[model samples]
Target: MDETAHALGASRTLWELVGRRAGLTPDRPVLLQGDRTLTFGELRDGAERAAAGLYGMGVRPGSVVAWQLPTRIETVLLSFALARLGAVQSPVIPFYRDREVGFALRESRADFFAVPGTWRGHDHTAMAERLGARGVFEVYGTLPDGNPGVLPPPPADGTAVRWIYWTSGTTSDPKGVLHTDRSLIAGGSCLAHALQLTSDDVGSMAFPFAHIGGPDYLVMLLLYGFPAVLFEQFAMETALPEYRRHGVTVAGGSTAFYSMFLTEQRKVPGQRLVPTLRLLAGGGAPKPPEVYHAVVREMGVQLTHGYGMTEVPMITMGAPDDTAENLATTEGRPPAGMEIRIVDPEGKPLPAGADGEVRLRGEAVCQGYADPAHAADVFDADGFLITGDVGHLRETGHLVLTGRMKDIIIRKGENISAKEIEDLLHQHPAVADAAVIGLPDPERGERVCAVVERRPGTDDLTLTSMSAFLRGEGLSVHKLPEQLEVVDALPRNDALRKVLKYRLRELYG
Candidate 1:
């Protein structure tokens, strides 16, 4: 499968890849949603007609079109249609509200906007009108259609910037991240190669299709010639039936996803949750080693977690054949073309096993931010993307991330890794989730504070007990959380469910 993917990876643009895959397996199923299935041939033909329709609607080559839609078969067709027309697309998450949506529309200077009207009880069309977005249109149950003869030739250059992905923007306005067709293809190839998937295996996409991971996963399907179930809204109670019905083999989106599956498995101990599930794989946030071990032991499934960001979708990914220790501890090895370099604060190269910033230079990395001003400090003199993540590389070529550069907590002139404390806190049976942040303190430079969500039926989780538990786990005295606050649930984003540390800081500071 990897060899085939490598050969197919030679295609220049995404449209070419789509056409090639459709030619190879025209009758094979590509996407599965509810009772509807879309085949490879239908995808090619449908996208062409859709592209002609969009062209008829004034969407020509290089036209900027922004769409905010849910994960549906129509959404996939529209995206590929845009690809067929060589139009620049800015996909906003369906859950984004006025501030984020307005910012994206203004920043991308989108010529046209597509909305779903009223989805999940929200009036998206009304919101678009309120924002004064140009060329506003709704694509709920129907799409634009026209004769295919009117469309021009597809895009030939894959290197041109044709995608604009926004950062989470938890702290401020989101920056538009620029990506190309070749870069997205490289990222998906790296991920598909790492997962070791086959056409016989079934997959699932529980996350939003608007995310950068959307194209990453789509490319994987085209390369491997497999079908994946699409969940418009993901929840354990409602999603389990689909998993069982489709016999999903590969499932997961991030650490939260792994935990959700584990929580379900615990209800019926000693029995597989989704009898067909063989692997749980994802990346986007840190994975506590304990979570990995828990999934492997409790769910009886292999969990392969990778490291990725919007700027560079796939950095390092765990393989199925990796050692148990490495799989549980490290983020696996990078593929052939991806380069991982560790550097100190001064930008000097750091030796293996030394903690430093993780820098990347590879085909999968984005060209740069949409606004060049946001990219000034993003790249260093060596031209590697300066990822704000802090980690070290083992001699065995595995990367282990500790925490974020700005996430480090300093106390009395000593630096403390928040992840170190958070990881230990997760081990406590009473804690369901945790986030450690540095709070402002007058006496000390900064104080370590631990905000945690208590596990159900465990109400005795006080600060004193938490401190004693940490000390017993061999945590340093100074690194111990000075203040402890309990919340019903930790604040998280809609995508990946990554804990919003900045939100925690703002609330508890």
Candidate 2:
């Protein structure tokens, strides 16, 4: 967070690119976790020190370092630290299980890794030990015996990768998307300018810093010279006060996270709901109509929805003053210098209003995947990155995502996305979270089965209550789950978001 760090360099590497913003407002609060707060000056110094520490370790530039630590201020500092040295830093989401973590460690070819002695409910050292990395930093309360390895070369060309982001891998293996210095600045500038961020903005970052939204928010905040207040865990009660106390104006996250915040705000009807929040941007899934209305009606906060994936991230994003229908249903048109197309199964572009595989061609589209073989499969002959999503552009030119081609449930010859049924069930007040999957069936090839996580402590929620709720929501009789498993919590992958379709098929079969 050095107020004058950006003045020290002239290049657009992530280090210099983000530092420019630091000089503009170095004393601003850039990070806050629990009681630990670091201003822009402090954050910059910490990252520099962490970079120095890595440099001392002999971590050569252009090397890959996969760090798995919780969402602490230290994690954020280490990211820019690695970036400064030109080592492509990759973070394993703190909650990722062994299967997800192991895949990324091997796939990314990590040279150095940092993990806690213990985190949440798992042992970290044991996890990294199995991966056989060259170097490891084990720090929980303390790690005096950590290995500091060789440093890599800084960027000689703009084409060199600054970082590698892996897709969530809901239906297949994760693809490592290589992001260059130009792409980072392109994305960072787009997010910063679109959100109307300035040097005065104070961002309360509560999303998982490991994901695109969290890291993207931090980079954009730095590009705007704004300070971000980081949160280790997202809870509505504690989050609101930090925003009001810090005079935070911008909050960036998904609608699911915002829904939880608004749910908690209902209990305290005070001055801090939307106190001074000027910008709110949502990624991942768009907010449902009911949740979208609640934010506007109750808190008077307007939120814009954005759409992106790992390969061609940030394809389309809604504007701040966009209409309600746009916010609830579709993400806005593609950004400048980007062309989006609705394509048939054969990769031919379709006319407007026809839903097919969504594809993008532009500077924002990635160079290719980390692995050449995998790249050949997902990338097309013409070079457009094929997003597995199925969507169509309206007559107005806005994109409306209807379904994901891979997420389709193959039953009764009906193509359906799990999202369609999940969105329907989410309308039920008694339902906290729900996941739909195709299960084995005797007559039909497969049947719809829902693994639902009811709101905590709902012993009195009878099956009759759920049935009536689904009936009212107008869910097709065929898509209804024949049997519902009311569990304590939905199973989540390393991403810490619910996707139990893989597990659902296992159980029902």
Candidate 3:
């Protein structure tokens, strides 16, 4: 990071960071949408006005406010206003309906709720009313405005738990992960440092701003004094114009995003998809080596994948200057002060290069879950957060994630990493995407199943052909998939488009 950004990242609170950046570059654009641009001065001044407006509505310091708004400049203003008031804010994904929204409001005991009215054909205000939400209000393109004189002093303490982000509730009810301002700033700082971005770079927020990544990317922008284009609804075709319009230099959300851009590039083989684009960086799902190679070779861009979760927003990130072998095969090294330990099943620390559960200790780690019931299983006795992810730290300090603990397929007491088989399957020309899952088998306890999405116009892939390909790739016989199912498209979440494995298991099992 540059000297100015390094100084800005030291600001105690999110509001303080905003103030520092605004003071330095008041007129520079911080956020850009269709035709609207919000400068740093506007962000700070607008947030203060909104803070006073919220104060008029009975929102005070420590009051819990929940919002389910889309990725717009208004959303950023409201969130920062809450920060200025020192209120505990709970940000719910706009795509979440009654169930998840109700759960968050009830669990957080929110004193106020903000909705986008009707977004993407869904009446969020009506749904909020149905759930009996308190202090429900609409903040689509407008926000409550009042004189800054009505607002009290901004928050000074950065360690207080002031943020609650929910996990994607695919299988069950969502869990509210707690975070403080300092932790979030730390997460964003590490990410900004690793990517080595500067003020000259124009970024894009293609994912939901309500996700944990929202503050992460925002802090990077604040620290670097750069602007990012916001996409309320992101699709490759729809977002391409915005990318070109704003001259987006750094773009990506996850592996799925890279693949989507690659698909677009394939249409016009030699032409640059987004002429100004140079780097693709993101984390949230596993990145296959083949995807990394394809993005670099075909799209002519540097693809830097990272490893992170809701609990810790930026664990490890691939740098732009990393070696090809390291970038393709491993997630980059953790930032300074972020300690990564690979531990065996018994919780003993394993040597470097040993595959084990990854544990982390860092300033960026979340304090704990909102529900104390879920906290016990999240940390080890040593105080490191037990990231159910299975991975190893190489001697070179790179992280090599194999798969999640739950993703392991145990067939007749032998463990098989679904990622290992999926990675190999991704190399198949006829296969566009694949998810390997284990289904119950009466005789063998569990049988390996491969669910695939065929490439367009490619020949159908059968179990016979897949097995032969796996064998030729040197996969063991026992690890070979016993079943194969092809689907037109794999189920994915709205934010990052990670393959929903649980959904596949429910559908195919």
Candidate 4:
């Protein structure tokens, strides 16, 4: 371990880490977007100016500010500015519309909301106005700037809840998961340590900056003093050039990203997609073993996947040096500070190799959800977070995720709540009962499948029609079911008349 890197990681707050990294490597490039680059020193200076501007606009410590911006250099600057002010910030996914955006703003009680105006043909500012969002401001091309001297002292405490991240609601509204600077740092530390990166290793952020992985990846850059290319909109052809230009040594966001790269790699057989690329690493969705083997075989790069969520940005990550079998099959091992426990239905600890619920306890875990009632249900008696994921720990310390207890489907690395779709399906006049389950998919990781019981005298409910109905109900395009099955009745357990989703999976998987 580098002593200076270790000391810098011990910084109290995100702003502190920024300052320390800037001091250590002021001239080293930290963020690269297109032809532009922001050095570590520029990151610190720009954030301070933005913070001053935010302060001039009346943003103070603990002020709730929300942003729905793309993965851009300005977005990173704005977020760090919020950190500099100790403002509680909420980041909404760029693709999320009025439904999710409204919920997040209302739940976080955001006093201010920053948007990119009209972006990619979507009128974000107009939509913000339509949603009656507070403090709506445009932050594209240019950002708020003022004298750094006008700003108040940076936040001293790193333990304060400064971030509210939303989880895709399974049966209800999205839950606001609270996080602190320390937690974010801890999560990023795990990722940096596991990857064994050096200052020379270039990375790429193909995912949304609003995603939890944003801070987690940034922390790695800060720790190792390496630069990363940012992609505002990532596609194989367009993104490849940026990766090549920046010489991105590490890339990938999830299983979907892996497949995308693989598809691009297949465009021309017996050729490397990017000469400098060496590793394809990501989490947030299950990485099929075959995908791992394919990437290693064809792309000639190490592919390491991990397990993470909104509550805990990084619980475990596959190390680059791990055994190929472990890398392909397991979600890797937790770092020194993380504790992974397999528990029975009653919450008793299960021995290694026993498949059970996956529970986690670590500094990286978020403080809890903003809603106290929801938080109460998520944490176990011993303060371990009940992840709602079913997995078993190997004696070798790696974790094997089997399934999830939550009624949510992960499709192409995005969480789509089955209950949300099922509720919508129940509203259809032709549907007497509905159950939504995720079926194994080669390309998508999992594809949403709706199995419905048709009402008496109703027939001819097709997948296309069902999807159209869902779209009419305001469901996101990603959440629309790709496969539909009209059945006589749904399988129900003997108790409580609950639809057995596992049975549906068995029948349709």
Candidate 5:
């Protein structure tokens, strides 16, 4: 049988056939908060209503709708609502000041929108009022006066356009990753099996609802007849209680998020939450070494270090219970069914261990970017999604991320990769966070500099200390930074906590 039928037989796509199981375990909790609870049947009812509402508004399949929401119950409902109507979802990670939001709105060409009047203390409704679309639903406050009835009916086979994720742009032009019903069902099914998701598991999510991972979790949980728990913020204080309250079995967060959680527990390790958590994995960015060490030893949660892009999330993931060396040292073997290849600039596949641009081919890979022009530069001749990232596949089948092809820094005649320097600095315990950027230099043309965020209350990180640490690690004197700027925090895009290299270039350039 074909993949689509296979997925249906396996009961994937929670919004599709996935919800048929909803009535099977009606009384069982479908969603849970400290005091709030929604059974599987209840959530299904709300989803039907939301779908009906959007349908009533005339949204058809392939309609692009953007959602700017915090981690909340409504976000999940809105997502399934769009899915029920078979319209595409364009989720923007929250609180992007007016400029970023405006860019996403205009670039995505969104037709309908659902945002909070004000979310997390920002006036999203007021900001979005200018959008003036056919339908607007606000949750943090009010969506305004416009109210459409129910959503349109689900589209026919192969017609659903699910998501349009925005990626960091090159040359100041943002790209929107577009996926079809085929990809979402295929990808979600891939995750359902890969993460070992089942009806019994409940996930505690710290990522934003607008992000692929957040909604991915939501869909996966519902796909398997499981529940999703949300935390408004990723604070350990709040996350812990929610985990205990909701009986959370799986929890997700970025590696940097884990680092912050570790930082928060410096005073008392026993006070930390997330005790019953069975599966503890991370994605969005490479895991810092220290964060990996703590998860295994301190928190006792297995860490699955995942490497993926918005174009195709979870291309590779380090399995939990794998050696700490595997999770920390390399982004482990590709998850089941996903494929990875390293290619030269000309797109020829490279031998194992050769660092070249990483291209991914999988059922999960997106069809194209919303901007056709950007999509032109994103695919290989055979249709593999060119993920701009550079890495190598070891003979052992493990993938090690080297850096970005575009992040090459040229200092005088020396060509340096910023990721190399940043990876070196991350090994230092004093270095909680670090980013490297190339700055214009009259003499060298472009020289590399390091900006580091130290552990909170660590007053001992000095230029000399950092240099000595690098020297001890046998880093080349040439590779050593001429400057080390200490920062309280690194600028981060909403879902990804990776070093905002773009912000670094802007600041230093």
Candidate 6:
């Protein structure tokens, strides 16, 4: 390991890393949102106060606190405060509702739940109350504050679980994936090293603060001593000015983000969307080869996509110095300590260049899920986590994902379980059977397509009405089906009558 990597590896906890960075560059701006700026020193100070306040609220070390907030300065402070207090935190996506949020709170056994009062026309505080959430509190414009002297000493162990991230379950409920400070730090280290970033580079966070990528990105800034612009709600037009204003050198959330930037750049034909942007890097959804070519040719920027999931924030990332062919065709390469194994159905390792289930083991990998039943099924005998993703390692060590072992559709980097939507569709009176599949979409990377078999003598269901029905069922807007197709019956295997989603994709894709 290099000197920087060695130092990062030595970080015992996230709070320790933050303190080191603050001491190194006290006045360096670490976060920029609108007219507000938070330097490394200021971040430490504010978090200490917040930590004291949280301590006053009966949140002791190892207390389970859950928060559902947007990407704001206050959110960052609250997260860091939790870290400083050594509290186990579960962050829910701001868009999640009763179905997801309720499950998270119950599973995590959150002692306290923090929320924004009312945001984007939704009342999160009211929703928390409706769920009878314990210790519900609002944290929008201001967070709790108290004297730093009341705060307890920072956590010493990094291996203990401090984070619970949710993965959109293939079934009805989401899995609470467990992670520790060391795992998050290791994930960030892989990204920082792979991207070849420096303290001089300015970054942007367009994704949700509750997403796994949030901590992963924040660790990069803390490690490199750089600043990043925060977008509470990222719209291309509104975010463009901020990017230019901050002189962002690195920007992108996922394939969708790259497409959004390219769409804006194509509006005027030869003008760059953000002139200061040199590298567009992200990795939640699959990136088509064409998207890479388009971004480089039209936007005049280098595009580097990687492979990651909620369980592991980052596994493999395309470096800025990698060959164009490798960057375009593969999902880059895993860092030195990460072990990627391609195995057959029986868990036998496969040869290079052969497609199989992708299993990973590394310091960045999450230890397990909160539920023991779920944990028992995910990890193998060798301790490698079975990723449920089908991919192969090239002779050059690049990972090329082919498909998934589960029926999960990744639309714009968000995992939408096909089974969840299918179960809801089955509830509709006019639907006899339903199968949801992700079709290849250049703009979204994958668009959700629902194919249903109508009940006998019932009126045909339109896409608009189906969407409205899903909305009424409290499904997140992003998970709604973008396309609808009616058929007599869904293709199924003869033995168990299981819907063959791959066949649906083959027919509709």
- Measured against the true structure, the TM-scores of the candidates, in listed sequence, are 0.82, 0.75, 0.82, 0.97, 0.75, 0.98
Q: Pick the candidate with the highest lDDT.
A: 6
Tens digits of per-residue lDDT for model 3 on 151-204? 888999999999998873222356788999999999999999999998999999
For candidate 1, the lDDT comes to: 0.87
Give residue 263's error in model 4 in angstroms.
Answer: 1.4
Evaluate all candidate structures by whole-model CA lDDT and list the values in order.
0.87, 0.67, 0.89, 0.91, 0.68, 0.93
The best-first sequence of candidates by lDDT reads 6, 4, 3, 1, 5, 2
At residue 181, candidate 6 shows an lDDT of: 99
lDDT of 1 by residue, 1-509 (tens): 46777778878999999999999999999999989999999999998998999998899899999999999989999999999999999999887767668989999999999999999888999999999999998886778999999989999999999999887422335678899999999999999999999999899999889988999999999998899999988878999999999899999987768878878998999998999999999887666688889989999899998988888999999998898899999999999899999999899999999999999999999988877777687788888999888999999899998766655654533346677678789999999999988776633436789999989998668889999998887554656788999999999999999999989989988
Error of 4 at 125 (Å): 1.4
**Model 2 global lDDT (CA atoms, 0 to 1):** 0.67
Report the Cα lDDT for candidate 6.
Answer: 0.93
For candidate 6, what is the TM-score?
0.98
Give candidate 1 regions above 4 Å deviation: 169-171, 406-509
RMSD of each: 10.7, 10.5, 11.0, 1.4, 11.1, 1.1
Per-residue lDDT for 254 in model 3?
77
* Residue 41 lDDT (model 5): 75
Clashes by residue pair, model 4:
none
What TM-score quantifies how close candidate 1 is to the native fold?
A: 0.82
Model 4 lDDT on a 0 to 1 scale: 0.91
Q: What CA RMSD would candidate 3 show?
A: 11.0
Worst 10 residues of 6 by lDDT: 1-10
- By lDDT, the better pick of 2 and 6 is 6
For lDDT, candidate 3 versus 5, the one ahead is 3
The TM-score that candidate 3 achieves is 0.82
After superposition, the stretches of candidate 4 with alpha carbons farther than 4 Å from their true spots are none
